[model samples]
Target: MIDPTLPLIDLHRHLDGSVRLETILDLGRQHNLPLPAMDLEGMRPYVQVTDPRPGVMAFITKFKWMVGSLVNYDACQRVAYENVEDARQEGIDYLELRFSPGFMAEPHSLDLQGVVEAVVDGVKKGTLDAGIDVNLIGILSRTYGPLAAQQELNALLHCRENITALDLAGDEANYPGELFVEHFQRARDASWQITVHAGEAAGPESVWQAIR
Candidate 1:
């Protein structure tokens, strides 16, 4: 399992979902947010997956404290920057880090557009510090419903230049691709690459719908 000549590229990664636990505890304390645990070991079970999860939703629950720590724009930036550093430490030569501005903002009620800008800025700085090539992808979290997805899409579009692609994630079974056809169309119109999470919790029909 040794291939030194080949390049290491990670095409699918969620920046919002890859937040550091230490940072979460740090930010949680700084903002006086009510975290389930105060120390690393105590907080691990809440913010991490120690046991097997039943489904996507159960697995997604681990993200609560991860995002809860994002209490401000600065916190968002720090998370993004750390993601890049982590990727570099893992020997990744290039990465595409995706994020949902709406999801990241909802915990703290931060401005959507501001979150995008801060993430872009943080990635830019991280690229320099880590000496690795990185690309940004904007995600529309379908768990928030169509109207709310529109607002999420708008925030992604606000920083369209900085983002290399658009992805549809969250509750694949409940929110099918049909609901986001228009949203991806707009993303395509913007000349961004399209990616989606389909058929994971749903049926083959979801994959066919994504293709259509």
Candidate 2:
């Protein structure tokens, strides 16, 4: 599994989902948010998946603490910057970090547009500091339903030049790709590439819907 000559590219990593455990504990305490544990080892069981979860939704629950730690725009920026730094340390040549503004904003009621701006600024700084190439993909979290997804898309559109692609993620089985046809069309109109999280929690029909 050693390929020193070839470039290592990661196209499907989520910025919100890749937060370090130490940062989570630090942020939680900094904001006085209730954390299950004070130490890294104690925090692992709450944030990391030690055993197989019941289903995809159950697994998604683990992301609560990850995103929960993002209580403000500064925290959002820190996470994004750190993600690029992490990619560089992993010997990655390129990385695409995807995230949902609404999902990151909901728990703390942070401004959607502010979240996008912070991520863009953070990734830019990280790339410069780490000497790595990183692109951002804005995700429309479907679990929030079509209305909120629209808001999320609009916030992402505010920084269109900074984002390379548009993604649809969260609650695939309940929300489905069909609901986002127009959203992707808007993303295309803005000259953004489209990538959807399909068939992970749903069926082939979901994949077909994504393709269509």
Candidate 3:
């Protein structure tokens, strides 16, 4: 067995995707959120990857339910805190957690800045409690189109102190990185580090566009 005491690093954990199922159920009850299922087993297939599908859409569906649970600032903070706590338990010494504020706030009508601040606050508390180091990355979803992408990037810039980097995610096959070159350039000019999710659902050309 692997040593539990050994240090580990996780570089690409998505905050929305990493939320715990128990927490989701709790949030659903506390906020009276309308979830598809009330119990864990009934909810598992909706929020967790249980099927053997070999496509990105199948994986992306899990996040739809998970994001619904983030109905308030407290919920966002709780998920961020638990994400770090979970990482610590798994022997993760350093982690870079990423999330799209627009995506998290869309269903609940929460402000993007509020979501970012809550996650940052939770990361601060979680890192101190877990004795681990963590960094936050704000993601821009290419599927949201250019206008939404610009707004999300603007929010990231406003919270640049709390956010360590900016990431591009979602539907790499349908939306190419060249569509947001200006926004990425703006982020680079602001001195923020950039990470693009490419070549996973799409081909090498997508990755090439991201790099360009």
Candidate 4:
């Protein structure tokens, strides 16, 4: 068997990734949002990661709907609160749920920071309700580059609490880590924890650069 004490860590488990389709359907009804007709057969490809598919486009699209349904405080609180209940069953303590505020923005110009704030509020609720130590991280998408990343950092600084880190993500094919050094450096200056997406798609060098 593989080493058991590898300290299983999940740097980036999308929140909506954990959401069941039934939940989406329920949310669709509650929020008066029309969800896309899911293709169950096509969805088979998405469940291949984390007990479900991690990189399926159809599954990915669901996050957009999830975001739409959860733009307000009540929805954010519910998701955050429920997440901890789910985490307890999984035995995943000290978890950090990294969210991409950039991608979660609403069509009505809902600032990226709004999404981060709502997510933090939800995370706080989850941690308190489950009596577990869970943390939230606002992941800045790499494709958006340093400017957008800095905005996320700035928002976190203004946020009251609940966030424990800021991460970089999005397609590894576009904009490698080196390009965002200055933003991360500024983050370091601000004393914010940092992480980046690497090794999942690109080479090991990508991981090295993200670390350095």
Work out the TM-score per prediction: 0.97, 0.97, 0.94, 0.76
Minimum summed lDDT over a 10-residue window in model 3 is located at: 49-58
When sorted by TM-score, best at the front, the candidate numbers are 2, 1, 3, 4
Clashes of each: 0, 0, 0, 4
Show the lowest summed lDDT stretch of 10 residues, model 1.
203-212
Q: Candidate 1 on 64-125: residue-level lDDT in tens?
A: 88988888889999999999999999999999999999889998799999999999999999
Give the C-alpha miss distance for residue 88 in model 3, angstroms.
Answer: 0.8
Looking at candidate 1, what is the lDDT of residue 156?
84
- Which lDDT tens digits does candidate 2 get at residues 21-82? 98999999899989888899998988779998977788889899999999999999999999
RMSD (Cα, Å) for all candidates, in order, is 1.0, 0.9, 1.6, 4.3
lDDT of 3 by residue, 1-212 (tens): 98877778999899999888899899999889888999989989898877687788667878987999998999999999999999999888999999998989988899988888898899999999999999888899887888899988887788788887888998787788888889888888888888899898888988888777
Candidate 1 colliding pairs: none
User: In model 3, what lDDT does residue 85 have?
Assistant: 96
* lDDT scores in order: 0.90, 0.93, 0.88, 0.64
- Evaluate candidate 4 by giving its C-alpha RMSD to the native, one decimal: 4.3
Candidates 1 and 3 compared by lDDT, better number: 1
